[model samples]
Target chain A: MPYLIWALMRDCMPRRWWFGFFAGLLLATVLSFDTNLGAHSLGSYLAYVSVFPLVLLFRCGWVLQQRTSQGWPHQEKLRDSRGYKAPLVEFFGLSTLLLIIYVCASIPCWWNPYPSPPASAGYYPVTIHFGANDYWLFDLHSPVPASSTLLLTLDWSQVQNPEQDVWIQDPNGRKLQAIPGELLRWPLSPAEAKEGKMALHSLPKVGVELRRPLTRLEIPRPGMQQGPHLLLLQFLFFWPLFAMLLAWHRRGKLSGTLSAWTCFALGSLAAMPMQATDLDSGPLALLARAVLLLKLALPPVEGLLAAGARMERLAFTSAATSISGWLVLGALSLWLACKEKRPVQP
Target chain B: MSTATALILDNLVLHRGGKRLLGPLSLNLAAGQKGYLAGGNGAGKTTLMETICGFLPTVEGRIQTATPLGYVPQEPLFPLHLHCQDYLTQLFHLGCNRSMNCTQAVQEALHRFQLAAYGKHPIARLSRGWRQRLNLAQAWLGNPQLLLLDEPQTALDPEGMDCLQAAIQQTTAAVLIVAPEKSGCSKLAPLLGTLSVEAPCLI
Candidate 1:
């Protein structure tokens, strides 16, 4: 891919001027994404935003190195050289084998026949009804003892007064009022709270009242924590694919189409099982299985997934500044690639 | 008329930068013949050679050739990393290499140019003599039926000139060169006809 990109821009992007062009692009990306990123962890966002241009920079470095070492190479008139070729069947067979191994690594057959979902295991969803009472209490004793986050989803249409306040009281008798987004989220980190009861209060003193008939409540155990060894093993499941892609990219073989499609597949697999999205299941669920494989295979640890999510939105969204920048770069590259060359003087 | 002619240029007028460069010139070369071209600097000597090699288009004339053409520019440019032998091989490949085995052809070219000792050296590090020899060596590969050289002897030493002259004698192809001095390669001088061109701006 780097070779292709270099070939495309060779005439227009002379070696002497490419560094400045790259610096300008880097500065543009940084400034464009600055407003969307919080200053508290600016480094994380910068790293995320820098990935694409950094990849481009790596390619540019490779191009420069090759040029300095080799000078004007044989213009790869790929249109002419049809002598060396690979059969498509053989390539497809190899790709399929890798994909099968990926699937096997995703399923927890040898580890656990019945694996639980993470969102349900450590968290609870619930609804509460009040009988002209100041507060309603619910007991949750089946939950395994551990710390987790508590979340509340209330039906907005059922509230008679917009000023009404709804709050949750843990077994420690500590209460937290609902914040904005109408979805209350409080940390239920106490070990006792995992096996104890909690209450929902309708505080009329805060001019808050709930005129609802029924509330749906769901409490789950927080005992599904994955061991570090298991997590590492799952992460290494796609080792073969990772190795194959690295080998291909390093070697710089394979046709342009083959290289591009292979990278696309590899990138997509690496990005699946998004940290913030719920895993879906249904018919034709092999897609989900693939995502599950990557989920366990390339687990985003240390909040990397959240950072990636932010980067994805900024780089891919129509409103994002980087999208226009990339489009401009891509168009310029194409124009350079196709432009007619004026014959060189003898 | 010759039984076999390598090239034919009839009343050819060449132009560069929308200005007449050379001729109302006319020339013909029989198969396996050899000659030299002459002109002052900026006199369109290089331009005329390039035009004959089909590197540049003639403003008003026709060029008819019986065999494929090969060109060696005055200042030969090649990839700095290309090995001497690899450069020959690539030349062979470019010629569609129907005549002989690629390795054998490259070896023959290297031996002809006396470059076998420096086969492994990077072209950038090669001296001017070797670079010029390599340039001519590529033109000689796959035995171009007609070879056009533009001021090829400018940087070459006496031994280099002797080697090129000897190679020209050995080849069964029409060889034309642009030379400013009529000296050197004494044995081959009688056969070296001159194609004189004038400066394009003067015209």
Candidate 2:
């Protein structure tokens, strides 16, 4: 019984956790034998014959050593002989340190959902409000760069107060510089953004056009842009090249790493479609159901292959909006495997 | 060259870290001919094999092959917690076209390698020897026309090696075994051909 519980905790706990698992299992097994007199008749024989319990205990210990300890039993002394702690442990610790730093740089503290406001209040409080009609549009074009027009399609019920003049602003919180005849209304809406009848706002004469309707504004500091840019710079220009160099230094594992990255790339790409398609209703839900059925009936190998092919076909005709849990799990597993010293072969 | 040549490398040159490993070399493997590659570590034996298997890029070589190739890399890196049966089945299905014949062939190969008991064992729990056998089994799953093995016998005992040699001999496809160490080269069965590292043909 201890072993069964340990097996259940294989990923979450290892040898260090064995004591609690063992005690719990022992209690359960004893209780079972005490309560069920019929099972007790042959229970001793069954318990003696069952090796899974012992195997599970040993396996848990092995996993603990592999996951939490410094090195393999044979490799521990070798590491000490080199006048250092276990290289595997040290490497992981150091990499984890660096990763924490990297993660900190990427943290979107501004996007955290904490500090909820009362229903009547805003988080930071919208600093400005503006409404624009034909007269306001004309004022915007005049003060801005050129002539402008208002192309209103969406129901403006929220901002229908005709008495007040509304300000039109850019993402940087700067008032948009409008050009003459900047707005154009079209009856047919592009399939990209589903909201029909888009209001076109173009910085005309300068040859720049806004692809999407401007409805919201959020100011971005130059420092924020630079933070992401620097992160990208390090990722694209430094870390990958460094990893390649390190791979060469540890030439023993290059092929494995390459294969692992290939799996990651493929999985990430395949996950895109599943992430994009909306599976809430219509034929899409039927297709999702078919995929689910195939997955349950066929082996994972065949199922993944068929699903990939089916997705390829659907990609040409439809778009995906949400990824299945399986793809997310696969991608996360691959990423974790990549961070390890070994390659993950599927 | 006759159509029997399953693979041909012409004027092959490989470079690692700006150092030339093997270069100005040429070789050919006719269909169904079993060949061996013997060399010291870092002598570019694996490099040459990887280039042939299309895993490594070529610097100044032209390799011509007319059939699908199967390769067993020197190291075995199995995914975590996967049962042996499922692992082999995955490899089998990968090589299988919609027919699923390779799936049965994978099972047969596993039985031949004395791994039937471990058919259900998780590959993660296996010893290095068992892992090596699983690697070799994956290569043979499809009975590919061209098979490349890198340090194929590193973890095998004598009998295990003999079983592999038998598989190579029984195969109707061409074989290229990259043996980095020359210690065990003499024990191969009489049917397979051997080539020394210093062969004039490779140069």
Candidate 3:
């Protein structure tokens, strides 16, 4: 009973600690507004258990030493188990309230959530068909200084003659010669195509364009700009966040500082919806502008992937905000663990 | 080992590192008993004291404490953010098992330990000797039935040692000191009713 009473009052008694705790919660809420307790929270809670309790226990033990004749109060309120019960109940009640508030504040982050990407930025595989003398046009919509690589897989099922050839070119009108050895459709029998053994890619990383005739594929050249500067991806979310984190890491100071880097990493993985940003001008650019504004207003959380079904929307920025609690807690764990030995900032 | 005994160790064994540190020992401490915990450096003096305080698990025997136990380890560490006054107030509430006026308790502890000026200071800001003083001051808050001082002289200055002695004299609980030298514990000679270490170590 004495032990139980002692345990209850130790945390409650520390005004500064409670102040720190509440301040942390408020900061996390305003910055992230994320409270879904998931694996990250569990991981962080486990870390909290592993880190802070020991020092608290050690300090409590240090204080509990018997040195003076000053003993427990003789007051009747302290004499029985009844005196400590109210505070214990109050502590439990406070805990529940905190949990509720933590959850309540995070609900807004999910309301009208932004679309997160399905992974790191990369090329998505797709298929296209062409008519006689037909070619494909490739348009890239990017908010950052990003480029794409194309892979051209020939539809061998439509081929009858091995002598058939196609041309390739860039928007600059430079033509790529058709390498005879690069065509694999010549060797495979139609029966092989029937068996699905001949379905193969011609040398890949090709761009498709209809205007250039046979050399229709176009890949973005270096130094290419889709639109005027500051139209997208430059002023906000992606560029600045990435640049700051990268600069910090490069200064040779972030050795074991996993928290800040994790934030950058998670944010980088976040994605925005690309439903209409398929062109450089007109409606696509307008859609891109609106999305840029949306991302600025909202933290673009991944669509609820609670199941693997949501994996497509999981991008870096969304992951960062969604797990911001775990990130902050993890950083706090580091701070507490390193407070005595070294300096750590979350 | 009657139910009224303040502390009892019946065939208690303490094991660490896959080896028995001390064990197959039995002893009883009556209320208000005082004893010197005399043992070699490798002896489980601190371990046994910590076990009695419920900080450790007994590997091989049954032990009992009839009253609330207070313990101070050899080295004291305080969180940087906690204020000395707050520490004392919390100690008072926990010690007395009730939340009453903590001002008096805090003042009394600060005065007793000569820490009145440092009361507002954070625990992290204090020097080592001051930290030990603060640690000793905590023991004076709740009148504990049993006090275990493991190497209480580790970081104490002469004045701090005197403060520790004064604090011990005020307690009615049994105090079992684990000290290396006689001079280190010389002040407690008046209350040092017995000098002993009953636990034997295997390695």
Candidate 4:
């Protein structure tokens, strides 16, 4: 397999593709320097997003165009000698290499070598303010573990009635009556509390301390967890579609039905409203549903971004979807390959 | 299917898009034999050759080959972005010549086809005649027992025609070429016979 990949890289990948690879690498590296442009940023999104399509288009499109314009006797020759497996290996091997290169190029965006400020064992001052909804929200710069026992020391010197005026609310917005205590002990549990805005009834100088020393957790960026899966899905989604389209083109069935379907599918994907609620009724909604199912089956970049900070679900769904999509597309491409064994009558 | 016969087509019928096109044809070419398939426009000559190479499924009868086959299609499409030598090298790797050195085999093919000077040149940069030679060179790789060339004389000059004839004559493979009227078939020495596609019978 490595030998085949090496052969394909040396022979199949054109000079322009190499140049594009290097250019994309440079662009990705340059974009990574801007900390503001992280995984979800458009630059990083385009960097990983464009590689699959570009590789697919150049490799498959070139083969299809050449087969259309001039006969592809090499395929026949290879088939005669070694059956059809060689070309299939060549196509997939080269595509995998390109995707690997894309991952390498986008590495800088996901990896940050510099260590952030260490979280020490001390009480950190927290600011408590009333939000627009009249609910008090606490702002903490550091991420607190869900299971930590937090000590919230409130200075009730300004409050006339310390018990009635000042109260702490749990994550669910239910108020917990504050007894006349120097420190309010709140035991955070994964089931009952989350790491988000915690409401307080009174405006006071608040300080929070965990049972253990605050340690900086090395949370992986969203792309680091989901990037490879996204690329794999991209390959699964596009490679077989291109093969099916090329098969249709070769069979002279592309211009009317398949082409229209392709255009409609693409148009529906492009016209998908930013907010999911925008798709409510009519043909657009139906198309949106179809597109949504397609996206679920093969999650696109938007799906990756929508996954956001919660990567576990994304990882699970991505694995399931990638496998399912790979199987379906694999079967479909195999069917097309079998159907295309005989030359179409002109 | 004899040990000495390279290819045998026994009453082979072909179809395209579910419509009957060519055949109920039969022919036998022994190893090292050379022949031409002649026909007018739209006679399914290329289709017949493609079917023989297993590119197209045969509708009826048996098409058997005793040895590995090589095919050169009419208006062959190459990786135009690849250099001539690189393309040949790829073919060598893809071919059944794993025992041989790829560079040496490719170099030999280039020299044989008189494409040695254009080794570094991109296939797209080559002239029509040179491209045709490159196509022939690729087909000759792996030293297959049978070689099928479709309109091998399409873009060849007189000198290119001579080069092709020499290569075909020197090769041990059974050479079956699709030749139009007044093609380089006349120049191909030790010609076995001509198979007319219009009649679907060997003459």
Candidate 5:
């Protein structure tokens, strides 16, 4: 194994690999900085985490293609040396090292001088005060269902009057009146009352029927929201896909490396139709369903990325389908490696 | 499968695209013995070499080897980005010479092939003759028991040809050279026994 790794580093670590590595680092840093400056939400963080590794993996795949085309691991001197096992081990070893480097690059992004806030259930607190005859008309960052509920937390000590009704105005300027329920006030100590402290659970939940899709929301909160740490899972999902593509390229089915890249680009574009919110029974809906099935057949990396960017969890069925898709791709790659019999020509 | 034999072919027939190409011939080479295979154009000399190297599947019969083999195709390709020495070092690590020092093996190969001066040069910049010398260097790097050379004399100058002849004379491995004409085999005639690849009969 040590010799295999040394050989791979000697032969496979071309200048292009180093260029890609530094480029990926720069890209990840920029994306992380952008997320820190922009929404600072879970979706933005997840987007950064998902995208940077993808760029690196694409470059790695290109390097693999170039070396494989030049007859790496299957060169004349290396024939009959433990079959595909050596090459596979070498590739995975280098790829894992790349992932580790990526993680180290991400450590600076995770460093925040101030501690992060408590995890809210995907809710950003609106800082505007609710007063009688004064309406806060703001749009949501994303669309929500008509039956979605809004939570209102108010400190009684800071409230001018606690008996007014709060209404949520939809995009069409129609107001859905909020009926004030029983006062669910928390018993606060003297020090807490002096500090205007209030528990979030004691807040009132108001049912707001959004008549139309809200386009934007103006939340001026300062703290960054923590997203699910999905680096490990993203590595698991994408490494296999990259390996499968490498294996497929090595199989010589597609004419050349350019064709392999084109196929990957087309597959990525096919994942775009999955972002359509309304999939009615039109031709677009048909295309979307076909793409979804294709994603189910392939790695589904872009589908998962889209879902992560939208801060939406995949439906149980979709997640299951994607898992099975990953399994199939992984199995196919292993089968290709094992069934490979022809010597690679120089 | 005698211990002294380096390679054996018994009734070995080869096919390409369901058409019989080369076949039904058998030969054997003992350890340290040099052999030559001669054929005209469209004959199966290269095909047979590829088959023996496991690049092509045999349509009938078997090919057995007593030890690890090294092969040099008629037209070998190199990774253009690698330095000549680095390429040889990688090949040394990949070959069955793991017990030896890699740098020493690579340096020796460069010295033997007169590539010592070109060790730091990228393979892309090398001329055809130099590339052929590099190919020969890699084939003889790990000192495999069986060496398969397919038209290795193609791009060599007379000096390179002399170096090849001297290297072949000094090596203890069993060498099989595929030559397209008698002139290419003339210098090594005393050390090698020649075999001809016959044209396949039309069905």
Candidate 6:
């Protein structure tokens, strides 16, 4: 993907500038350690961004230097003598393959058949009753076991309306609320709580009060802790698809279209699987499973259930939509690909 | 058959490395005329060509050509990845504002230069003669009203030079051939109508 990006931008940059750019990026990457990448790890992030431009700069500069002194006739001879065009089959086939791989990689495979090992597991149970303006907790328990670490995983759901807010009070009057789009992960060490390393007042008086009945909750457990790893893998798998796209961007209309479509399809596929594969299956699990079930049964069932002409029409329309999407992407890429040539004298 | 002169250079003075190349020079190249500028090695032939091509900064002068002039520099500086046909296409696309059948135009240009066989060829593999032809082809691809050639006679063999000279004479556009040495002048004599660097400067 970076190669594609570099190739696309090679003409826009001058030969002399890219070397130092890439070198500086490499230097920064070398200086940074992966473990040290906290929120403050700007160096590591910049280093990653630097790789593409640097590669592009070096490649373009090398080509420029190798050909500069050859003179006009030499260049013309080079252009005129050896006739070459990327074969149509190679172009389209490679694009199609990359697209498929990209799509497959992108498909979010959220389901894990094997049980995950327990890192730290416990659930927080709470009962609550409704108040005038909000809900008040009736009971709360800190599932703390001695010599073991406790991860507080709260399940928030709207049983009645499915759109209500849920709030919990720590030991202190301070409240921990579950917003519409948020994750809750709290670690409690029994040793610290026993030694009074942290003030009891700091721990909110545990109480669960839902604005409505519990309809859904993201309960964190030993199995569900694998979110980060799964997310990373999902991200990496989609990387190559994006890379192929960036590399082939400047090749021409066809390749550009294929790369873009591949990126889109792969992106959608990867996202779906990643989203579906949670150890903690939320209320949306059924919806995700239904989609997966259709995908699994698509090959044979599609032919048997749907009429041949109907299926053909559906497939043709889907393909047409994808092709059109690629065409638009190609047009945009081409517009951006044609670098404004520097004034010859300058 | 005088159309308003296509190119006019007046009091054109150019200095290279503290030496005067073209000094207070003046000339008028009328439309459709084949003209040449002859001088010694450092006598400002290339400097004059560069100046006319708007590539060099003139010390003191006024020069004008058709709005879209075609210049074939001594050396062709282009990207390596571009093929000959693609290059011609790019030139045709950039040079013209109107929508025309550029493919046919390109085919004709290739045939005219005897480069039809090398139409889809990559520029990196051609020999010197063919490459020169490609250079000329790019300049002629636009079919601009004004054409500028710099030391065009240097790399060509006798037969190749003859073909070039004939092409130059056949061009309908006004042309300025810069040939500084006696060999260059003698070689290009058949194509040009008059040779002068001491003519009245057209202000």
- The regions of model 5 sitting more than 4 angstroms off are A1-42, A45-52, A73-78, A112-228, A251-288, A296-309, A312-332, A342-346, B16-18, B189-203
How do the residues A1-346 of candidate 5 rate in per-residue lDDT, one tens digit apiece? 4655655554445467667766765554454444354443444444555554555545555666666567664473245455665446545665666576546544544664434433333333322323322233332222232222344332333334446665444333434444444222222233322222222211232332222222122222222322223444445555555555555655544433553475466446534433325578988889978767765555444434432333432211124466567657666775675455554322
User: Candidate 3 regions off by >4 Å?
Assistant: A1-346, B1-4, B91-96, B189-203
DockQ of predictions, in order shown: 0.07, 0.03, 0.03, 0.19, 0.28, 0.05
The residue ranges of model 6 lying beyond 4 angstroms of the native Cα positions read A1-346, B1-3, B18-20, B77-83, B184-203
Candidate 2 C-alpha lDDT tens digits along A150-226: 33323333333423433334233434443233343222212312221123332222223232244222111112223
Give the count of colliding residue pairs in each prediction: 5, 13, 28, 0, 2, 39
Error of 3 at A198 (Å): 38
Clashes of 4: 0
Tens digits of per-residue lDDT for model 6 on A217-251?
12233123333333233223333333434434433
lDDT of 3 by residue, A1-346 (tens): 2433444355433557756555654443333222442221211221222222223323322332211112222111222223343233222333333333334333332341322211232234322333233344332222111122334443433444446554554433444544434521122232321221212222233422222222111223211121111112111222223222322322222321332344344443443443333347888788868656655443433321111212211212133354453334334433332222211110
Give the better candidate number (3 or 6) by DockQ: 6
Check candidate 1 and list the clashing pairs. A126-A217, A127-A215, A127-A216, A164-A208, A165-A208
Model 4 error, position B46 (Å): 2.5
**What are the RMSD figures for all models against the true structure?**
16.2, 21.2, 17.7, 9.0, 9.4, 17.9
- Leading candidate by TM-score: 5
Among all windows of 10 consecutive residues in model 3 chain A, the one with the lowest summed lDDT is A222-231
What order do you get sorting by TM-score, best first?
5, 4, 1, 6, 3, 2
**Residue-level lDDT tens digits of model 5 in B1-203:** 67788888788887777887776768788898887777677677788887887767666878887456777778787888888998887676555455777888889889988999999999999999999999999888877888888888988999999888888899898888878766576575342433434633221
How closely does chain A match the true chain A in each prediction, as TM-score? Answer: 0.33, 0.21, 0.24, 0.48, 0.54, 0.23
The superposed Cα distance between candidate 2 and the true structure at residue A56, in angstroms, equals: 29
Candidate 2, DockQ to 2 decimals? 0.03
Best by DockQ: 5
Q: How displaced is residue A132 in candidate 5, in Å? A: 29
User: Residues B48-94, candidate 2, lDDT per residue (tens digit)?
Assistant: 77667555567786877645567777865565475777656644433
